[model samples]
Target: MKRRWIPGCFAALLAFAATAALAASDDPSYGIIAKHKANSAVRISDEGHRIVYGSPKTPVAVEAFYPLRAGGEGHEWVFEYGYNLVTAFPDKVRFVAYDIATPRGGEVWQERGLTCGAFLINGKREVTVNGKKLSFLRSTTMSGWTFAQLKAAVAAEIARPRPARAAAPKKPARPAKQTVIHVTVPCGLAGPYGEIVHLFRARHPEIRVTTAANGIVAMLNQLRDNKMTSDVFIALGLRELDDPAAQKRLVSGSITPIATIPLALVVPKANPAGIHNLEDLTSPKARTVLTYTPNLSGGYGARQALQEAGLWDRINSKIVTPKVPDQCKQMLKTGKGQAAIIYSTCLKESYLPDKPPVIEKDLKVAQMIPQNLYSPVVIGGAVVKTSKHPAAAKTFIDFLRSEAAMKVWLDWGFTRLPGA
Candidate 1:
């Protein structure tokens, strides 16, 4: 899918904003909300509404809904919450159902709903679990939680009488067992590279993976900034076998090239630019130009190729550098740019049933300038030194290169690496 950021009409924009506000209202306990605070590593508002705050992926401000009972009452009460997903990204909330019994065996109760990682509580009831005091006024439950069994333990704590403590403050409840491995994959909606990483995590239960498609360059820059630790980098072959800095960061000889992505120059299938080869771009007759943004690592590779051939000056004269591949394709289709350079895989994908805004054949993969330095950019994965699970990281990387995983990458516009 070619990514085009078509500015929404004013009415549509208003509707979206209104929807986001309503979504935020689902959990209303307001206070200093800590991140990764509980066993789930999720922060909650000081006055527990049972609302779990924080994004499963880089949580902005707890958006998933968790309606809590009034005043944290332990007595049975109905709770519900609704979540509005942002259109820019896919929002998937896993729901978990919990059944709790008070220590006195007063009554059997159940809580259920869908949650990203935490829930909201709004009532007056207080429960002590693992020593720390927790309050639940309004209770909201989520669906699809893997640790459904933990809720009962929580309820028992709530039902028991308050335990007396010495002069010392109660010790904080130990954080959840077996910390999850956070793997953020940067791939666009049209690309399947991110999905491949998810599969790798599934096969290895000990590890937990989270994926985000921040475009290739943004993803790399994120790693560069150290905001997040990517246990493994998964993207085009060029990202792995080509980048000098990327190569330097790898454990010596740990670079595993699993697939290849061909580079192609494209224009709206209309061929408005009449772009032919390296020489035509410099003719000064070309109108608007399109190419990967310099900020992206892959864009850097493309620019390097241009500089080596002495076409940088000519190309830079008429350039449109979009942040991601999808945006690059959109520029041409919407007539924003007369021509664009993108991955050949995008062209093949354009042939799919609901083709992107432009036809594939109209955009030709400009012949690789001085084909000697030009080769399909190999895409693959590697274990990062910052990863806590070195063994698991290496295992995941090896799995990506394995025959079973290669088939998936091969189908997703990646080619076999040289000498693989």
Candidate 2:
């Protein structure tokens, strides 16, 4: 599915190789491979043809399609930006791409940035992943160096000793040990990081709170192993907090609910599939999109809503379960899914400041599922007992319940917990 395929910058890059170069129904026929060599962009198509481009912003040719193997999801037609090139990966050409992220699935989500090469996929996306992606049914979900990071690194690998250039002035070392506390949450809940951290910093300037959103499973594994990428774990589900607390991975009684998120029935722009409500998914015309199985973090609420509606058995087979929520959105944005079940906060996550989220042009909330359909998802967290910064962790965790932080959370579409 879409790897938060909201293409804008390099930050959101991540996903896997699709079958063949692309799906049969897609256009452009072949994706033009791009490379940086000798200060020029070399664009090469599948037919062994090549084009030398001088400008960094030249339009790279591309073909867009979905692999039938990716749960039979549809192709995303990239806009004029033509990020559709990402659909045709596995070209075996390694380049210093993305900012570099790794691993997938943990008590927190640790996902490989992406197996394919899509452009800056965060703001004003070039293209989105709107299909069901190949889930890691295999043992290894994500591992190893999937992409290059620097041209110098690649040159070093080739044993090419070039003339040395003068080194630039060294920058200052990390400022005298700020009490940096890393907080990991699902991407949808990441929107408030700036505001919350800002307010916290206003009073606790010595403490630095860094927040990132990913699958909770990926982060937890790191916590369990004491890797401690996170000092504070704010998750989309309470199970994440409870399970670790049960194992004594966290400080005693530190686990607590931070907020609750309601569910939404999301549809693509213009309601192309004619899905006006949840029940419409059962019809031949609708593709009820879902997050991958083990739905703890991805399609957790969608599965619940359908089951609560007594439509699970009837609509289960027709669902396309992507590996993540972004993938589900991608399927819809690229013209695949009829409806996606997701947290209402997800709308806030993808909302553009220029327009309201409910009126999002690419995807719209078709229905706001009643709370009676399912229990509100409890997003909670705890201070890691094994943390390198325990005091700072507790400080930030405590700040989450503060009046200031609660305002940011609510602004980001979360409901404040009782007595928070």
lDDT tens digits by residue: candidate 1, 113-228 = 21112332221123345665542222222121222222433335334455553495675553355434443443332234444545665676565443322345545544454533
Counted clashes in each candidate structure = 53, 38
TM-score of each: 0.49, 0.57
Worst 10 residues of 1 by lDDT: 101-110
Best prediction by lDDT: 2
lDDT of 1: 0.45
Task: List runs of model 1 lying over 4 Å from the truth.
Answer: 1-180, 194-208, 235-254, 276-279, 283-285, 293-297, 304-316, 323-326, 348-376
